[model samples]
Target: MATSYDYVIVGAGSAGCVLANRLSSDPGVRVLLIEAGGRDNHLIVQMPAAAPIAARDPRLDWAYVTEPEVFCENRHIIEHRGKVLGGSSSINGMVANRGNPRDYDAWAAEGLPTWSFAHCLPYFKKMETFVGGANEWRGGDGPQSIERCPATHPLYRAFLEAGVEAGYERTEDQNGARHEGFHIAQSFTRKGRRCSSAAAYLHPVSHRANLTVLSRTLTRRIVFDGRRAVGVEAQTGGTISTYEASREVILSAGAINSPQLLLLSGVGSAAQLRSHDIAVVADLPAVGRHLEDHQIVPIQYSTPEGLSLSHRLKGLRRYGIGLRWLLFKSGLGASTMCEAGCFFRSSDRADYADIQHEFYPLTAEMGDPEANFDDGFMFSMGLMRPESRGHVTLKSADPSEHPAIVFNYFAAERDRRIMIDGMRRTREMAAQRAFDGLRRAEIAPGPDIQSDDEIMAWLRSAASTEYHPCSSCRMGVGEDSVTDGEGRVHETEGLRVVDASIMPHNVTANLNAPVVMLAEKLADAIRGKTPLPPSGLVPH
Candidate 1:
């Protein structure tokens, strides 16, 4: 492998894969994509239903647990980052969400006009080939193929119907015009297989002579010469290799690792760097200051035994599901059982939909085959725009050691208030007459937990991450930001961040789509391509 390239992108994640594909398109320039984990060829990664299995397997998942969260009863919440080529996008629930348009418009309101909904729609369209076909708002032809969930299960129908009965409209396309309603899920799937970022972007262009992908190579730190990033020190099979980049070094290691990398490279607070006996490269105090993530509290309801999908997992039927998927890629195994969900406001005073919901057919932790669970469905509800902030700090000077992540969830009063309201809103939707026959007793946070105080207490123990962490290395106009609107590190040259880590704040939906969109847009700027004109289409 060549020891130097024009562009060296760390972490072959959702963002990095896109960068590798787009940047390598110019044969004149060479690109090297480094992945800390091995290849994402496991059956657990290909089959969509095996998402949970892939998330906890040490071979594929980082399985980084956070520092005990004080807001959630001091529970050490699990943070499952995909250790494979596609990163979290490989193991995450394949929900293809772009969040609300207002999310980007708000970014524009913050003085980064290029990130407004109008400016971002083109890139969102550029990265995705919506299975439903394209329009003014949705993209027609793109790399990532997105398909809508069939949501044919009786229970799925009931949940969606319940939302309508609770006075919400059934939205056909959540990613289009308006998203504030109950909708069938859009999955990052091609045919029946999971269309991971690696599968969609990197694998398709593997034959490119200019592109070199190095797997199982853990990047130690950025090698900088007087504030300009030159390359990175990486370890491959106990062999330390240095790869120099003549153009730029991009860090797409997601929210946690990116911040951790910055801190380890002496690019964070000078005091913090000195504590680890590391020399300061730049005193960017905000490197890991605005850690944000969505915390969902599950509201589970027991369904009749035969009505639940959990019943099929008992014996031979379970094996059949796997066999069917392996043979023809059709069946329940072809999809991440998370079919139905919605985006809605907690109350009238709220801005665009402030809360989000995702319904899963089974409540069991599929990761543990030995652990038994009841036959039930759960609605994981969370605040779309969470205000709570936290930080990612190095545990030690050791490069191999995982960073200490603290979500500080619900630290903001508004976050706490919205969560309780969102929980109540979830209950109201579930209680609709549509669920009368299919749904049985309330399984979790039962009838007794009705009052605000009871719900608040229950939330302290129940709420956990939705696996969408962002904003540890935010891009903005102010000093609080680590990067600029162009994704270049504030004071550092030739170093850029193009992932969810650079989000000014977390988007209103899942991070994968937003991260991919971020890369697609920034890749143009990096190549000196003129920015796409902002769209004028208005959301209804």
Candidate 2:
């Protein structure tokens, strides 16, 4: 007989891990969590500094590449999605940013009243235990642990000081009442170890008898009776199996996979499904539309010698740092390299920050080992809210085939203008007196690329994703929306999406923290628990 579960969550990613822990807490409920990849127990995942390595590790990352993008000079950008137990949370840079509250208010205005910043704030607090103590804006005790980066390095300090010197405000906590300024980053780390969702939520509850976590299980399709999803057909190792979901089958498979799964199960555009020779169940045209991501162009500089993390990569020192982290979980290995960042408006006309910046202490050619060096620092300027839209479509009917993704970045004239302004602003920050002694020369876009046209040309060739993708199965009120306000598929029962895909639009910051909060909010709705009372704090 097929194993029966009260809840079956596909894709043990950020949202799936949280759902497994929260839903199975009742003891009476049986929860099955399926992951396409294996456990996240490797040291590369445990150490915060090893995130970049984990992102490229085939065993840990799906490493999906995009289709050629016209706005990006027809180049295919590599998109890394974590395949391990904790999903992208295990492989990401660990920056825990909640984004601007207004971003959520904008969602509320778009017909998702329950998702406003006022309503979602409590859930954000419910999922995190911030190290700086709790306040009206921060959470105190929660499953996920977060620590503020010390920004102790002179380079980090210079970066923050330079932001202020450039006339930007200095916010103590970006996740607090105000986020429009320069601030030290907060990370998903505790005691110097990466606190991935698997580590924080799933690992702690794995002993629960009613909870079953199936690693290396690839969900092929949703098994539906009539129009209601009743179970999932999946493949484990060399065998194909069916698992019954007595109550609900939540698709927390993320932005790319969730919509793909829905489309593959005969739930997408009628014409598209017919092309693949699949019978249509629900013809939702927006299943894979509205794809959004933060596009970033890096600004690297060859800093004065010995100022970056380059020295740590040298011969014996590399092994020594590894030993220190493996033994005491300290030293350079304990940090996520990206220690400081800022959010600011690109122009005076904007009411809030539309540009975000990240500072990296070490500089190395990501994939080219021969170009790896030890004495440079870099920062990336990312547009917070891009107007350009994109889509994700099935490459074929095969579930094993990755979807074709195209993020038409810079397609909107406003987007291009903002990016250009962002580049100019980044140059201003780097030129600040705070970096006067350390700054050597600009490595990317060089000093020669000065005009607006030159910067636009450079961006078309060099811009890349910040790796935050969402809104493929966007939640809204119309026919174009795949899911409703609470994540229920508009015309389907017994199915829901509880990941970044449900975001009506991408938030102003990193997607990880918001994704986790989405799961927490949805779990309450599923359990029939009363919604937490809004704190009534006005949105900033």
Candidate 3:
């Protein structure tokens, strides 16, 4: 690696990898992409059913346990994040969801100009290469290959039929004109491997002479010149050192680490920074505040008889499946367990209803739900439009110290009320007569658990994260905003943040696609080239 580069990106996660690829395309610009872990070329990291095992395996994961919560099953929940070259995308269920169109509109409504669905859709199309082929809505030739999940599991098919029988309409494309009702989920799988950001953006370009890819490096903090971010200090190969950005320092770290890095670098609230003896650099109060995450309360039920991956774990059978995955890359090892999912509204939902009902066809046994699974389908229902807010605060000035995360989940009465309605709605759909042929019995909250109080009790005892945490470093038009709509950190000349942390609010679905889209747009902005918008509209 050179002593300096045009762009020094921290954390080779979803967004970072994309930025590294897009920004380095200039050939003239030298880019440095640093990661905290090694390559994402592992077999477990590519296969889908292996995601659970990969999530639990500390060698490839940063298994973070949440602070004790008042409503989370009355215990601290364990959260898993990938620490490899592709970050969470290396270990996450490879669902390629862009959330609802209304999600981006909400950001525009919050004074972030150019963030509307109409504005960002081009970036989405630019980064994707949909396997089913694209029309006007889907992108045909892009980097990420999005395809429909194979019709392998019988229970997933049953779930779709049940939704249709329960008075719901069939939506062909969730990322198209509308995002509602039941449908088979699209995934980021090219052939049999997960098309993570690294695979899609980094792997092909790893040989670029102008680009330097460093692994097993832990960034301690952003080194600053006055209030401007000049570079970063990190530990590589157990040796402490610093890397200069020369032109710009972008923090593409995920929501958790982005905020933690800001706080550790004395770029947060004056009061909080001073408490830890940190000399304040920039008093950005919203640096670690306004944290939001999607909470899922699973509704499980047994299937009478179907190929549900439940019996596959018995004795030598699982090993056989593993052998097939390692050799042929087919069978249960090729894709994620959730073959199909739906987005529907509570009967009384008002403004938008597409932010609920994300079902998965599996059940687990531990704190991180993926770690403990036996057999059954689970419908994870919650308020996709949560009003609750939380934050990531420093425990001390030490970068290695665990940050204090107060999710304050279900703290708002509105959050609780919406979740209660959401649960009722899911159960109502699951009880449809179409499922009568496939489903055996309700395993959780059961047929006897009926009442708002009962549902809330179950939520308080069972709710967990959907693994989408964002908006800790929110973008806005006001002074309180951490970055501008273009992702430029306000007042910082060369620094920018192109990750989920820049999202003003949580998208109504999975966030990986949107994060990649942000990087694509930011690349255009940095290169001073205006790519064609989805509708061919030019700014006045």
- Measured over all alpha carbons after superposition, the RMSD of each candidate to the real structure, in angstroms, is 1.4, 1.4, 2.4
lDDT of 1 by residue, 188-230 (tens): 9998999999999999999999999999999999999999999
Candidate 3 lDDT score relative to the true structure = 0.80
lDDT of each: 0.89, 0.90, 0.80
> Residue 140 of candidate 3: its Cα lDDT?
90
lDDT of 3 by residue, 406-467 (tens): 67688888888888877777887888876776677898878888899988888888887877
Is 2 or 3 the stronger prediction by TM-score?
Answer: 2
Provide the global lDDT of candidate 2 against the true structure: 0.90
Model 2: per-residue Cα lDDT over 183-270, one tens digit each: 9999999998999999989999999999999999899999999889999999998899999998999999999999999999988899
> Which residue pairs collide, candidate 2?
310-374
Instruction: Report the error of model 2 at residue 329, Å.
Output: 0.7
- Give each model a TM-score: 0.98, 0.98, 0.96
**Comparing candidate 2 with candidate 3, which one achieves the higher lDDT?**
2
As for candidate 3, its clashing pairs are: 73-461, 364-372, 364-373, 365-372, 365-373
Candidate 1 runs further than 4 Å off: 365-373
